[model samples]
Target: MRGWGGTGCPGFANLDKAEPLKRGVQCPLANETRVFRISDPETGATCRYAAVPSSHTFSSAQQVCTSCFGGQLASIHNYHTNAEMQFWGGIEIKDTEFWIGGVIDYQNQAVNCHWADGSSWNYAHWQQGYPQHSGHACATFCVTDGLWRSASCAQQMPFVCEF
Candidate 1:
């Protein structure tokens, strides 16, 4: 016997409409230790380090690193250790210049830098007799033609926030 309805398929009119589900916005990785890689625009060098804290003045960067990243800025144990060949250290920021993590030793007029592996500044990466101590005591990373220079930390500039 033939069916009463002209169409053999069942009607979907009785089915309920599929509503779109709303999702909450959230960071992919929250409150977790993660490594971030940053590249220098001028030098074309890439640096990878565990999460970075918010970018702030030299003094503020220290505080944030201590409170957030467990200690001062991170350092590169051996650039060659990582196949990537680059790392970020706890250098300070002043104006548009980057200063080694060290402050005036008082006894000696040398720039001291902090290392993440609990090592002191044995190697130096100054830019032709830098850290001129012009009354400004802050550090910043330079991405321009110059890699790291001394500048007033209070000055605002674009910084790379890791964590």
Candidate 2:
């Protein structure tokens, strides 16, 4: 099994499956550009997310957000923010889950889990009976139930980015 971003997450062994987002030139919105932006009026933090048609490992996704977009992965701090992010991502009730900023510290024996942006881990919407026994867990927001679930960091999936 390969390591995820060389971080020792056994679950991220399938890093080869990860893919980068596609680049292209397309029509822009009238008098403006349409970007996936979600703003929380309460916290005054805005999140910009793009859905990469290609898949990427959790670590790879995080890197792309920081380097390419000048933002870390999107961190869901509260219910409103989570809802807005979901809406911006066009997440549907039956859609598959998408990666977020929450990640388990594999290097630290999975002892700590936190968002990439160092925000308060105050609110979590874990799926009922979650944070599974799965090793080196990474968080994914479920579009189906609008809840968060722990998944293997190695899994290839499109992710969102936030500044």
Candidate 3:
């Protein structure tokens, strides 16, 4: 099934979700790393996102992100981050569908989904009865309903970018 990021606007961001380590900083002990926060640190996303209005095939969209924006498609793992992606598309391309960094794969006749950025697949907000799961398909975000939907890989549409 497709995963939701704001309004179905397809966008991508850099991959590298793991927090980078400082050159000389010692690894923190498990207890030392345990800290409380008002919200998940990933809520705001470490990268920035942009909603491109121009339509493109999925591959083209990805090219644009990597070549022009220096990032790949976005990876959404939380509701808050998904909502943020939606905001960019909704505000800049209201009610438009965009690409996100999601691609469904098949393994042992079962369907699996992942973000192009290679982050953990922990959440999804699919439109009812969606993802069709019949062929090679990609994930898309919709601004009109703010839900995730599946689409053919070659379909031309707007997308989001994170860099």
Give the range of the ten consecutive residues with the poorest summed lDDT in model 1: 1-10
Instruction: Please report the candidate that would top TM-score against the real structure.
Output: 3
lDDT by residue (1-163, candidate 2, tens digit) is: 1111222222121223333333421211112212366566775645555454346788887776654444566787788877776665654222377788897654534446788777768788888877774457789887656688888989987676664
Write the number of the candidate with greater lDDT, choosing between 1 and 2: 2
- Alpha-carbon local distance difference test for all models: 0.37, 0.61, 0.63
Which of the two, 2 or 3, has more TM-score?
3
18-122, model 1: which lDDT tens digit per residue?
A: 211123111112333244555545445554344333345556554544443333444433324222212332332223333224442212555544443355555
RMSD of 2: 10.7
Supply the TM-score for candidate 1. Answer: 0.44
Once fitted onto the true fold, the runs of candidate 2 whose alpha carbons sit more than 4 angstroms away are 1-34, 91-95, 105-111
Best by lDDT: 3
How many clashes in each candidate?
18, 1, 21
True lDDT of residue 155, candidate 2: 91
Task: Tell me the tens digit of each residue's lDDT in model 3 across 80-130.
Answer: 767766665677654378898889876677788988877788999889977
Per-residue error (Å), model 3, residue 83: 1.7
Which residue pairs clash in candidate 2? Answer: 12-154
